[model samples]
Target: MDPVARQTLLAAMDAGWADPRRLYAEASTARRLLDQAREVLAQGLGVRPSEVAFAPDGPTAVRWAMEGLLHAARRRGARTVASAVEHSAVLAPGRHRATTAGDPSLFVEVPVQPSGALDLPAWNAALQVPGTVAAALQQANGEVGTMQPLEDAWDACRRAGVPLVVDAQACLGRTGAPTSYDVLAGDAQSWAGPGGLGILVVPEGTRWALPGPPDPDGALSGPTRHTPWVPLALAAAEAWQQTGATLDADAREATALVDALRAAAAALPDTEVVGDPVDRLPHIVTFSALYADGEAIVREFDRRGFAVASGSACTASTLEPSHVLAAMGALTHGNVRVTLPLLRVAGGRSEDVARFAEAIPAVVAAVRAEVGAPRW
Candidate 1:
């Protein structure tokens, strides 16, 4: 979190600790702060405040968004369509729904191009697959940073009368909020806000319903499953304001740094830099080195005072091969992913990225050598 956002969070913790559901004076104050926070987020997202709802976190919001649509359209169809590279949050529930229904066809996994961009023709055909109730596509790929063709995808969904649930979790703070989704989901942490806060926006007339049992207060009809913590909401709102104030400048710096990193990785022997170089996220870069171990590469970077990610972007803890890379036909092993922090955050300067770039070649060589992989 940025220093100012952290300070705001600390201040809000003291000022908005009361439960807003109560009718007491302190509760009223807390309620006011929560409402103000909602409005701020709505304005930042370019949506109506009434359309915004909070979730426990980003993945939950995504699950709710997709599940809600599927639940509402149960009679119409059980089928759901999503790109193969969608975050595990979207794909896991999708596969579960299909598995539980005893029909694999209930989930349609569309393929992507080598650049990590969706195959538009395949996406269009999939949407037309008779029973698709909802379709999900991230605004950008989190692991490889490839931006999807949202407008084209949304148009196809519209033609097929399927609701589009966009997991904007990766692009919300970095690339700006998306305007083409029927339901939008994002994480607060993406924008330098504290974690545990997820943003869900269901525009009016979106035809969505809560997937589970009704809220005791009949509040499940709203966007959120539960009331968000007032302090976290306020802190998120502050972070949004701070990020929005500096979004363009921060993106330019990140873009340059990522470009440098990408160039360095691409120059290394048998290493493939993934994602669309020109149409991708400004701050994320991923590269795969043949015959090297992803975990070993991560350890080397960590020892060099630079933290990095490896394996699947979502399933890294399990050391699973990246479905994103697999779908893109890229190398799945020895992958390193970097997501630069927001400029206002610590370790986000140009010098930090430069140092990392300078170490990439040696790190890859050292890892490959240890594994007895021949140099090109």
Candidate 2:
């Protein structure tokens, strides 16, 4: 769905364009408006305003949060753990092992089912390993819309004394992070905010070590007295508030669309819909047509004027299926992701999803025909 919130954001930006950190009266007004935004975020997410800090975008937030967890591990011991479903930004840094020559690093990944949620048995086994450190999990799947058993898995981490780092990039404003996690990270763009904005929230009393370009004074990214990046500050607040109000409606529309799409998908000879059929996000659908190159289908739909995402939209062009989908051990290489937004009053209607659903058959059919799949 198209978003009207863009207009709202543009207008807000026009009005509050002054630098929020400036000492002058105009900047002071921007700063005051930012405070209310932070309070809204705190209220919406059930955390204090001090816990949230804004970053450039989702990947940046993911990196920052992972770094904090890694620093926490260094303070306590020397091991780090995560899941197979983690985003690339989180997994890449954790792969390097420090040795006697340096600080060796090692990683253990909890497996997931083909539907993309965590594999409970595999997870329990991984966390039980000796010298287990922090664990990372995503609240929702950007590729498949499957939700990990976060509260349960996070409770396991807590019981094992392993701090849990969560990627809430797809969950913030839709399904806010569960409070049990040690570190929370997400991008604002997924929720219709500006592209270059993300949030990293550290709860009080978490032994996170953040020594970097943004935070070196033993404080968060913002200075001790004031914060920077107030537009993100405002985005977080407004998006969450708007999401809470329209979640049910959006979910209702998306569910029906998914049901229809799943029925249409099943007609294919060797294809399957991945992710939980129930208990998942309302906004996304992921499926794989066996033996079809994902890029081919992506191009077919792109020509059809349907803007679909292949894997996580932002990270897909790296010539790999999402780690989340790969971790699920499903049909990874030939998958497509469909997303619906919490649109504004005039932006989209149920018929739009239906039309998109109707278009999918033609798109897939064209792709299959082009690939020489037998027309049965």
Candidate 3:
């Protein structure tokens, strides 16, 4: 973590640690702080704090979002569509289960451009499918870091009378993109907030389907009198306010780095960077080196004191090609995903990044030399 981020966390932790549920002055402080957090977050996301419901974490937030969308749109029927580049939660095959007569409920696969934008033609066609209740897509790709055209997609779904659910897990607050989604989900950890807190931004007046006693008409799940919910909301909001315009800066610098690396690797005979070159998210880049092990290069970089990420970080177990690249008909098995930390020193603007960029050719050369990529 960056030093400034760390300091912010420590301060937020100290101030937000008080349980807002307690019936005392400390509790009152916590409640006020938490309320302030939600308001701040709403300001950053261009929504209302009342619309933002905090969850325990990101995956849970996703589950709640999917199921809530299902319930909210249940009156329509059991059809859910998600972009092919959607996260695992939305891409779950279970959502497309077999029904009576052996025909499965439709789980339409809408294609997104390599740059992570919605495929308008496919989206238009998919929404026209009868019984289509809701659609899900990440606000941006986590692995590839491409921002989706949620505004346009949301508009299309609206025109088609379909509700849109977005997992803003990686892009929320970071990108500052406009969202009019029925359900927008994300986590605090994605933006340096404490773990165990997730966000489901549900605007007021939107109907949501939740599984439970139905005590309250709004909010995602759990009781309103919960502890830490208020604090986490407040902290997340404050963090967002302090980190405004981050998306543009991160996107710009990361895009430049991607271009730098892509050019450097292009000099090699059998190397290719994946994802859309432009109109993509600015913070992430992935590439595949033919015949060269992804882990080997990542490890080599780590050894040199530069911390970067690889596609499907669990490469040692399954060297399978990245699903995103595979979907694009591009290389996958030997792919690396570099996510630049918001702090510039983490290879964003300093020598750390320049050195990493400079080291690419040598790493590719060394790996290719060992595995014999190609002579030309």
**TM-score per candidate:** 0.96, 0.87, 0.86
Clashing pairs in 2: 97-104, 97-105, 98-103, 98-104, 98-105, 99-104
**If candidate 1 were superposed on the true structure by all CA atoms, what would the RMSD be?**
1.9
Clashing pairs in 3: 37-234, 41-237, 146-281, 321-332, 321-333
Segments in model 2 whose C-alpha atoms lie over 4 Å from true places:
1-8, 97-105, 212-228, 312-318, 374-376
The clash numbers for all candidates, in the given order, read 0, 6, 5
Candidate 2 residues 227-319, lDDT tens each? Answer: 546655565567666666776676677677777777777676777888888878877788877656677778877887667777632336676
Stretches of candidate 3 above 4 Å error? 1-5, 12-14, 93-103, 114-116, 215-231, 245-251, 312-319, 344-348, 374-376
Residue lDDT tens for model 3, 204-233: 666675766654433322322123455456
List where candidate 1 sits over 4 angstroms from the true fold. Answer: 212-221, 312-319
Ranking by TM-score: 1, 2, 3
* Candidate that would win on lDDT: 1
